[model samples]
Target: VDADTPSACVVEREASTYSGNRGDAPNLRGPKRSKPDASSISQEEPQGGATPVGNRESLGQAGINPVHSPGPAGTGSQPVGQEAKELLLFACGVCSKRYMCNSKLVIHKRSHTGERPFQCNVCERCFMQLSDLRVHQRIHTGEKPYTCDVCHKRFNRRFSLKCHKRSHTGEKPYKCKECKKVFTYRKNLNEHKLIHSGEKPYQCSKCSRAFRRPETLKYHQKTHPETTAPRECEG
Candidate 1:
């Protein structure tokens, strides 16, 4: 029989009989419950004696097989026709996003609920994950754990170090889809996009003149130094 065929698979429900002894298996014989709906079965449950309902080929790719099992039966039970191998997935209630484990799902739910459990002792700033909180604490600690081999420049985060190395390699990985122009940094590419859209988001407070870059606006503001307010003392 083809493994992919749904009709080829058969579910064998395990049954136990009571002998009124401590070592005896619990009596499962009761009023016959209806067959469990394939969709309703919890992924956390053991897959023993469970038969998948759909085509094995398509289900195998998704890392889960929709199992269906009949109601309780006699003590004598046969093995399931096909082995049901699946990785159980835990889904988020708010966003419907799925994870491999309940802990990951709990962590992912924080993004929707805005729950930050881990906090930095120095800044008292909270983060959703412990790793993020640890990284944030580095700002107060002044710890640069990641170092560059080329220029000996150090960065607090590994990603910052990776981007820094690209400067030495002359790697311009970020490309403008419209003009096919490449940029060393994603921020520069984003700023270049403003030229195509003709959007000058940074406007001078002193005048109606606007610029695509904040630095350009700052340069323009230099012309209005007489009108600009004096800097307050830090004290």
Candidate 2:
């Protein structure tokens, strides 16, 4: 769906569920499964099939917030009922995740338990099914598996199919209550808090200098060699 949808639609339309290699070549040719019903779109059942999709608390509480988000000033939540039309699928292998469309499940079945019965001549990666193998072969030949609906980023994996929803929505579910700053990434939010506390856990051995991130410390150490040793100059 477009950015007009809910504030924390963290997952995208395609990647709601993952479809990996089934890990079975012999059983790959088994009977095809039926498409799921159209009315089945809801919070995914869960990974182990423990709670039914309708019963999950976190899926609803953390995802797809019903209320509108606070804008620059006094703007209210984006009205309810504005949702993207997503496809649906059914995973019979007893997994908790749900799919939006029927064809998706058919595609998803390829990735369970090593089911690559089909073979590609150009590359030896066996595919559980044909279409997936086609998608994979595109990799050796360098094909864009999927293009983003927004922005210039392209990915080879469909699991990476949907572009990061936060980029467009600008909804930072992970927030630092101490500073109240928002971050698109959870790790970034965690790092930002260090600024408030003035904490630098990562340190460089060569220069005895510190940095918030390891990369920064590594970069700073390079400057040590080019510049005169401060300790020697002082002596």
Candidate 3:
């Protein structure tokens, strides 16, 4: 949970040499890191300090370029240590703290990472990292930070915002070639294809009826007392 009041506007902004590594998610530190190129050196993390960049200049804070340290110049980022002239920039907007090494910087970056590492073992879905997964396990304890930009809708992740955007745009880029029926997105296209193909991939073990859509199949299972026809016949 964030401590800063939502009404609090940024007081000051500073720039420094602390663009932390972004190979992995800052919030979701995986059990093992993906193997990176040998020439590449992941920064350990920089010392802590406070160096302002600018205040209230744009829609968001100004961020320096981020990458792993190297031996010398001739590339985008600076070489390891101070030998590189490029100014290292690192700081957390939430708390006025700057770091040099990518490690500490990543830790600072975690606040912005909005990492949700926790996941449901039964569901096999991934999250930001273990700690976040643990915190989210409480969702099985009921907690929600998500808020709806429109009427009264809220969700846990930004992806939900993307899903909700469709409602406003009414843009369905995906379309069925056989029927020319447009859909919201690619996943919908796959689901829609089942309709024309008459492919009832989802079957209810509790009952004998088959369903083209997963949700439809789920709803049909409710009538286990007798053989009820699936309303998703439109599928």
TM-scores of the candidates in the order shown: 0.50, 0.33, 0.36
| Best-fitting candidate, scored by lDDT | 1
Residue lDDT tens for model 2, 78-141:
4343232222234446564456765666556656655667888886768767777877787688
What ranges in model 1 sit over 4 Å off? Answer: 1-98, 101-104, 204-209, 226-235
How do the residues 175-218 of candidate 1 rate in per-residue lDDT, one tens digit apiece?
Answer: 99999999999999999999999999999888999999999999
By TM-score, the better pick of 1 and 2 is: 1
When superposed on Cα atoms, how far off is each prediction in RMSD?
Answer: 26.8, 38.4, 36.3
Rank candidates by TM-score, best first.
1, 3, 2
lDDT of each: 0.79, 0.65, 0.62
How well does model 3 score by local distance difference test? Answer: 0.62
List candidate 2 segments past 4 Å from native: 1-144, 157-163, 226-235
Most TM-score-accurate candidate: 1
10 residues in a row with least lDDT, candidate 3 = 10-19
Task: Give the deviation of candidate 1 from the true structure as CA RMSD.
Answer: 26.8
> Least lDDT summed over 10 consecutive residues: which range in candidate 1?
8-17
